[model samples]
Target: MKWSEVCIHTTNEAIEPISNILHESGASGLVIEDPLDLVKQHDNKFGEIYELDSSEYPEEGVYIKAYLPMNSFLSETVEQIKLTINSLKLYDIDIGNNHVSLSEIDEEEWATAWKKYYKPVKISKRITITPTWEDYSPVSSDEIIIELDPGMAFGTGTHPTTVLSVQALEQYLNKDDLVIDVGSGSGVLSIASVLLGAQEVHAYDLDDVAVESTRVNANLNKLGNQIIAKQNNLLDQVNLKANIIVSNILAEIIVQFVGDAWDNLEQNGLFITSGIILNKKQLVKDKLEQQGFKIIQVNEMEEWISIVAKKVL
Candidate 1:
């Protein structure tokens, strides 16, 4: 079988939204090549080694590559993807170069080539994300291991935004607490919440692909019973009071649902938001504050930011 490798030259800020666009268009097995990964020093406290090849990375902007089966509707699907991505500019998202190109490759090549880029990555104090194909063992008895099959999802669950969300969950989530994971891509945060002792989780995503991916991943970790994955827009009509609400979506989308988030969270419950660029930090912070949320912590990783807000009122 043949596969079309659709590569987009974009910015760090556009990663989440563009990836969503591709995933919604039926693209699978994404590969993100960022030059920043080469220069940035990763935290090796967990003794995980990161090996990156400079030749595969762009010298300037980030490169997002996804695999789509070459079929009769391939052209139409690609065009629709391009249109949807361009629409992101309406929301003030920086798309950077936005140069999209395509190449034909054999399925055999794509099946294994992208897997080399993913490894066992320790994102937080207790959470570690490893691909299903990799053999990894915990360095400590208390370590939390999350096995993800990237082929079935948009990411490997090690993106900075996801890392920050998982870290916040580690810090704020209580045992047996109910967690609401908005924009639950790959259901990584929801899985992490369960592994960290949450009794149950409600995972919601706007895209059906993401919803199914969440379910598949949840079951991959033997956590199917604890996570309820569904398709829903950001917190729309969600009335279940949660002990913790976490969203790792773009800041633009994050602000649109602040009121709903506040209404659904229990008093003194935590609202953890990531997928924010540096410039949009204040935008989300102000929106959360306007909704009566108290800003408790702000963390930065690379060009991304995560804000943890508490429902004080």
Candidate 2:
């Protein structure tokens, strides 16, 4: 099999919204590579291991995003994705109209390129996500561990958005709350929600890789039965409201989701969102306020912002 990918370089502020726009136009979820994330790969002396300890990681960078296709390839899908980008006036973003093609390699072979980079990261007071093949145990007196062999998904627990989402899930959820993770990348948030004490967690993402990753990580955490990973874009299949909703997605999706996010919340439900840049926090805040969600708090780390809001009745 063969595949095609269209990548664009955009400022961090434009990446997520453009990704969502591309996804809506037939491209699947995109790969986001913030400049610092790319740089960290080269700084072997202080690379990934340093990210585990907050003080070690670099603070800011631009973003690189690639829209991917699978099974069969379609030029029209690629064109539409590009058109959406152009039509929306997504700033500081550009890509060749030509799609990059690749011969499909067996999954195992394809993943080796990443092994040199994946490392065990302790994300919370009690939780750690360790990739398979790494030999680091949490030495902290009683740290809980979630081991994973992540392939092509979102939950490495390294991104501040992912970390903040996990932290917010821990802070807001209780033993009996029903939680939903809207963009359950790598299933990290869903797994964390269960580990944090939610009675159950339902997760959805448009990316099959992410859905598969969720399942893999769920088993890693030994909560296979408690976490349900499904393929639905942003609450499309949901029928019931949840006590907590966590979305660590781009700010524009946060804008588009604010309405549905408000509608799918149980009374007083908490909506925790990340993947927001420091420059555009007000755009999202304005949208949430328009949706009748009251901002409860803002968490910022190295220019990334996570906002916690309550759906106002």
Candidate 3:
């Protein structure tokens, strides 16, 4: 079989949204090549076993690559992706050059090409996300390992948004508490919640692909029984109350359902939200406050921000 590699040259600000666009367009297995990663300092405490190549990255901006099966609708799909990316301007995102290119490759080559970009990294104090292909062992008995094969899903469990959510969950999740993970991409947070002693987790995602990915990762970590992965919109039909609710999604989408999240949580229940850019941080915070949530903590990593609020009313 043949595969086409679609590469987009974009800015860091646009990575999350553009990646979502690609995933929604039927692309599988994404690779992000950010030039900043070359100079960024990584802590040796987690493990610095993987080597990187400086020559493979662009001099500026970032490149996001994904694979799509070469089929009759390939051209149409690519066009739609471009159109959707252009639509991101409505959200005030800076798309940079927005140059897109495509190349053909053998299935064998495409299968393993993305592995070099993914490695074991400790994202938070207790959580480390490692690709399934890597051999990673925990440095401590208390460390939690999330094995993910992102496949075509949006979450790798290493993104700043995800890291913030997991770290917040670590600090706030009570033992045997019920967790509601909205936009549970790859089910990483649900698995983390269970690992952190949540009795049961209800993981929800609107994308069927993400729902399956979450289930796959949950079972990979041997926590499938503890996480109920389902395809559902954000808190629209949710009736059961949870001790804590976590969402690592865009601030725009999050604001739309802030009220619903408030209604779904038990009194004083924790609500953690990420995937917000620095510029939009205040906006999301204000929305949560308007919905009767009290802001408890604000965490930031790189250009991303995560706001943790509590439903006090």
Looking at model 1, residue 246 earns an lDDT score of: 96
**Backbone clashes counted, model 3:** 0
Ranking of models by lDDT:
1, 3, 2
Model 1 C-alpha lDDT per residue in residues 204-224, reported as the tens digit of each score: 999888899899999999999
Model 1: CA > 4 A from native? 43-49
Candidate no. 2 TM-score:
0.73
Candidate 3 local lDDT, 1-313, one digit each (tens): 9999999999988998898888888898898888777676655333232477889789999999999999999999999999999999998898999999999989989888777777888877878889888898999998888888877657677677787888899999999999999998788899889999999999999989889998899899999899999999999888988999999988888999998898889999999999998999999999998889999999888789999899896
lDDT of each: 0.90, 0.69, 0.87
What is the number of backbone collisions in each predicted candidate, taken in the order shown? 0, 0, 0
- Cα shift from native, residue 304, model 3 (Å): 0.9
**lDDT score of residue 162 within candidate 3:** 80
Which pairs of residues have clashing backbones in candidate 3?
Answer: none
Q: What lDDT is reached at residue 207 by model 2?
A: 75
TM-scores vs. true structure, each candidate: 0.97, 0.73, 0.96
What are the per-residue Cα lDDT tens digits for candidate 2 across 1-313?
A: 3234455544555555565565555543234555465444422221134433333222443333333445444666666665676755544233323233333334444345345446777665667778777887668866767677655435467666777787777677889888888888778888888877888888888877668778888987799999989998787647868999999887767787788888889989999999887876999999999899999989876578999999878
Return the top candidate by TM-score.
Answer: 1
